[model samples]
Target chain A: MSSFSTAKPLKKKFTERLKKDFKNHWQMYLLALPVIAYFFIFNYAPMFGIVMAFEKFQIKKGIFGSRFVGFENFHRFFISPFFWRLLRNTLLISIYGLLFSFPLPIIFALCLNEVRNRKFKKVVQTVSYLPYFISVVVVVSILFDFGKANGLITNIATFFGWDGGAVISSAKWFRTLYIGSNLWQHLGYNSIIFISALAAVDPTLYEAARIDGANRWQQTLHVTLPGIASTIIVLLILRLGQIMGVGYEKIILMYGPSTYETGDVIASYVYRTGILDADYSYSTAVNLFNSLVNMVVLFTANFISRKVNETSIW
Target chain B: MMKRSAGEKVFAVFNTIFLLLLCVVFFLPVWHVAMGSISDPLKVAASSGLYLKPLGKPTLGGYRLIMQNSTILRAYGNTLIYVVSSTLFGLVLTILAAYVMSTRGLLFGKTFALFVVFTMIFNGGLVPTFLVVNKLGLIDTRWALIIPGAVSAYNIIIMRTSFSEIPGEMLDAARIDGADEFKILTSIILPVSKAIIAVIVLFYAVQHWNAWFNAAIYLQKSRNLYPLQLTLREIVLQATENSIIADADGQDVMIFRPLIKYATIMISIIPMMIVYPFVQKYFVTGVMIGSVKG
Candidate 1:
């Protein structure tokens, strides 16, 4: 009885403190209430719905009433012919994108940093970012026009001894078109980070390099590169984290049946089977697998980056 | 100043010329579209190469036709509605979240921050999110576009970083003058944070302006509710031009189809191209602010 009395007083004191805090910050909580509710309904609720991956997931039966199938959906997906194709396409597109898109921005920034004329540099930078603001739908439309048979790009290719027709619909050209367009659209916008990082590089470092008889090329190699090395490393780590997250929006807009051989990715596959085909349980399983892979890759990248360079996103 | 070596001079000249060429390459696609949009429709259809200029006699017939198309007009209106409402809604929620986060020594502040940041790393995939939206009866409704994507955790973090930079003394001064959190936020915090506000507004506005996937998935049954980009997708990508080319005869359809495609592309992108140069610096500022550890 004595122990119970002491515990009751302590609990009462904790409640009193919470009440006082609430009273003081009721308005703040009131402001946060809607934001909290928004995330709950949209984000957290769906996380709970991930359970659908394990169930039959009939629309009529609903998530809870659906029959549980344990890893059957995953097993089916693993054995499906599309398993290897989707995996290969996703990895190849991401790797090719990383190869071309990633370093180009840093190189673009470095080149821009070397310009002596400010107005010309600003104009080039501004014009370059224009495509980044253009809608992906429009970008694809432009691609369709340019990649059609007898179109400008096709004509150019023909002049260079190429006879392939309709580049947009060609499976062989899918990754090239996708990655090339991505480079055109994002090169400037992505380089903005490195550009700012370059701006932050100390001028005295360049001066010191010059004093040490280092020319502009040597200065760029020694002072300029190392100055933005951390930014580059950090951005690289972040980019590595998103290796599995090549977005479905552009892919869906760009891909047709003819090019799906090379164009279809995991996210687009999920959209096709889940939303369009209504294969809810199976698609959810595939998506869950993708998300798990993404998280694992992100953590592994962050871990390796931290170990090697002492720079991590977290 | 020291005289430049021959090698350095050559490098500088080459660098300038290369950047100039890049500018030309970047600007040419838009130029092609614009030129094609104004060209004679039949000429545009027959032509297969880049339109350096209007192929034949320049005409405003394509623009006139596009203006008369009810579907394009309605979709444009819908896009305007989506962009305005989504931006306003997102800005309010972001400001509220950012203000709360920037508050020093607030109870459960760290927990609240982590709650927001956790969504960035992990999210419910497409199927589950769609199911949730469906369960809420938001499918085929405007709310699906506005509500589901209203508060990006990224924008909140950016705004929070900007808000945290505001001098705390100003806030404390207002507090001492019997101002509440809301009042301080409006009177002191907001008045001084216009640059960040412009940045966030631009970010949200452009996002909504360019967005079509949410509309595609949500407004599948409601063609009337389709935004410009979705309509653009149907016409340009899906090649479903019946809605836009309804009254035209067979011959005119062939002629005007390519023109209409180019014209529509130009119309949709013109607003962005026009607004971008003015707001370019703000976006650059936003990027720099985002780069700061938050």
Candidate 2:
């Protein structure tokens, strides 16, 4: 450290500058009060409550009064028969969703962007967004009704030389149906951001490519792909962050005992164990596990994107 | 253009055909529900591919049954109340927070901003959130649904971006003219940010209207207090199928499954389709705020 006699002038100058800045901006603190309070109360405050997950949380005794349970809640959940099956099913469903729903909106947007018939494009966009507005309960009920072995879809499948026999009940078809329905629901609405990203590409680049004798497909691959590459990467990373958080509402309503063999996911298991069974501590442990895995995936994804593609959600 | 030989033409034709077919597949469930709802139970059961052009006179019986269900009316009322109250309250808070964050040199504004972003990455999970809500006496009440979800981090981000784009000189001029912060917010800030505000309201409205998960968790009172979605869900799942079966009088009514599903879907989606177009312009204007802020 510099001697006080030598450093005194510099220290005084720094303090004086900081003081002036604070005095000039005092009103800013007043304006920031409500927002700071909101996040503190609603968000940061809840963080302390995460401790309950690790305890024998008793509502009557309170978190402070509850006994220190160590890892018992987690151990209980992991030892349950449903643990591995729920995880496998969750992974499979998410994989199917990734395969189906992920590419759909991007492809749809690309196709729609390419369409010369604007009316047809508009109609497609409208119908696609329409399904997103329909509640998951409605979507599931409708699916269930149409899923009965002799229901409309099943009967029609018979004419097409296929068995739609109890599709919802069959463990094999659960992921396909769920993923297929999801693709239908979100394809158009999710395409909006991709389309916007595509819009930002300079038309002059395309014109230059055309002048260079690049064909439609060639131009698309060379120009359009690079232009939307960052958008795709960022969105992909975001999607990875949500990998474990499957569509809980629709899954619960559509799935039953018959379909549980293939259809049960971590979220649904947590719901049944945590909410319906009222095993709060166990569900919290399982949910916390899912979140930890999700956080890892999110950061790894963000890091990899940053390294390989220079695109990240962070 | 890819200079197409005959093979390329065939491929292009195949691609278009495939897309069209996929579109039909996507639309089939909707058609199935609509057709099934109107056809007589006997006829619907006896046929396959129950088309929109009915084989016989389309019956209004299913709709009449829904209309007769008193719970549906009550739920509809509850949904409207929740939607209006939540949208107004959530929007007000989001705008205020966004405005405050947008203000120049807000002391520790950047740190305060990071706190908002912090929520996106972490949470206490459901049990703790439920405990917090319960501790606050919000559980079992409408306040649980509204207040807990009031400040969407996404909404605040976009609204903040919109507010920040307002020139500082304009706000200073308003201040010099003796306009308070609230007055400036209403007269100047809000007027300029109307487009983004509309998008957030639309997003929040749809979200609140579609939400029943929170209600399922929180509300312990009368089923009569159920929102339209929750009530209609119970009726559709618990009643319509079984009630129809019980009344079938040995007649096969299973075929009516797809029919009534369509009617329910059509009715449920009608509100959104009707309301959405009226606000299309504003929604399209600046929804890109979140992704592409300069």
Candidate 3:
């Protein structure tokens, strides 16, 4: 009874403190007003509209006025033939990326750390990051040029008496082209995080390894790799979180009707069926499904990271 | 000096060659396109090997065609307007939000941060966002391009991380001098946080400059308001169709289409390439500190 009575004063005191702080920092509140308004209107407003996924949406009826049809849209999506195709393509491309592009950055950072020439290292870094800044349209254009009959790559292949048709048009080559270009564009930029992790490794550990008669390879294995293991794991978990998400913009720009079998992912499917066709309820249902899968995978990865390594992004 | 081991020597040589080769491979494709742009159109079309240089007499015909194209000019203007307005608006919101979140005595700062970060992990996705924009009557307007993507949660988080690093004593000193929160943010905090500001501004600028998806979706009905990337997309589509596949027709059209496409790509990317080196030094520090801490 005494503790319960004391809680009233504590609650009153907390409110009084909050009031004082607000009064003192009214200008801060004013500064934050526009930002708060932006998020509410732009971010939160759409979140509220996610309810449209369950609705039979009509433009005149609006989001709230539309009739709710629980699970019907999801049921429709689940039964659709495109579902398996999009799911397969999205997963395959993401897995291909995970297998290939994920390790290249780590290896690049490790290789860069071993280089003695500072200027040479800087040049390589600069040139490699150049493609990351290029627009998706331009990257696709460059890829098209390379894949074209008389383009550089095609011409080089033809020199070896190989068929030099447009590589992008072939369904079989879509995964290779997409993943290869991604590696080219992002390898250096992604390596920055790992490079920083490498830089943060203790010099004393390297000296100790040298004293122990460990060669460069042994030092890298025992000392350098261990030093960046947590960072690698952290980044790996983050990458796994994005396993369902692919660069739909590049795919949309590059894919033709011929290659749609391999190139169409959930996002591009959403764009086609939702935005292009204006199937609001159906697309929302599809996108909601994508986001849920992403969130579940993300949490699972985080859970595993926390359990195994005691490090996870919360 | 102690003689280096043969194993170390071989490894060093192998590593150098590998890095240099990787650098060349990364650089050569873009370089090839740039050279193709300036090469004589006829020679460019006829060449079978990799384009190492301008194939024959160099001409500015491709560039001249681009300059004379009114659609390209209009797209350039549209892109510039979008980049400037969006960057300014975003930077202001980001800095102000970060400052408030970083404030020492701010009530409910954690709540506000959770509100922001929640959007990063789970959004309403593309359809709902489009519907919201449509209902707001921003659909086909310039605001459609600028308003929706104006404030990114990642940029806000990164900016907040930088702001929190500011010394508490400095803000305390300003408070002691009776300066208002707004005054301190503008006069004191911003001046000290130039590096982060530059980084965030560049982030916003690059985003706006490269954005065509929103334009493709929101302003699909409006061609006059299409950004540079969208215009480039149309140009390339026509060029590819005309040059690569439609070969039985006009030979002269084929000659210049590849050049036109390459020149357009160059023109679109040249501005970013110029600014990239100057800002490259800031990127490592800015990105590392911003992301790794978060």
All candidates: TM-score of chain A: 0.95, 0.88, 0.95
lDDT of 2 at A36: 69
Ranking of predictions according to DockQ: 1, 3, 2
Candidate 2, lDDT over the whole model: 0.75
CAPRI-style class, candidate 3: medium
Docking quality of model 1: it rates as medium
The TM-score values for the models, in the order shown, are: 0.96, 0.89, 0.95
TM-score of 3: 0.95
Provide C-alpha RMSD values for all models, in order: 2.6, 4.0, 3.0
**Candidate achieving higher DockQ, 1 or 2:** 1
Per-residue error at B252 for model 1, in Å? Answer: 6.6
lDDT of 2 at A244: 89
Pull out the clashing pairs in model 3. none
> Candidate 2, residues A1-314: lDDT per residue as tens digits?
78879698988987887788677665555655776676676676677777767888778988789888888988887898988998899888897798788888888777767765667766666666667777888777776666668755566666787664767677777887798778777776778888888889998899899889777778789999898998888888888988887857888878888889999999888788777877777778888889899999989999988998787675
Question: Where is model 1 more than 4 Å wrong at Cα?
Answer: A1-17, B247-255
Off by more than 4 A, model 2? A1-38, A156-164, B1-19, B45-50, B240-264, B278-287
Residue A227, model 1: lDDT of 97
Ranking by TM-score, best first? 1, 3, 2
**Per-residue lDDT over A90-128 for candidate 3, one digit per residue giving the tens place of the 0 to 100 score:** 999999999989999999999889888899888988887
Better of 2 and 3 by DockQ: 3
| lDDT measured at residue B58 in model 2 versus the true structure, 0 to 100 | 85
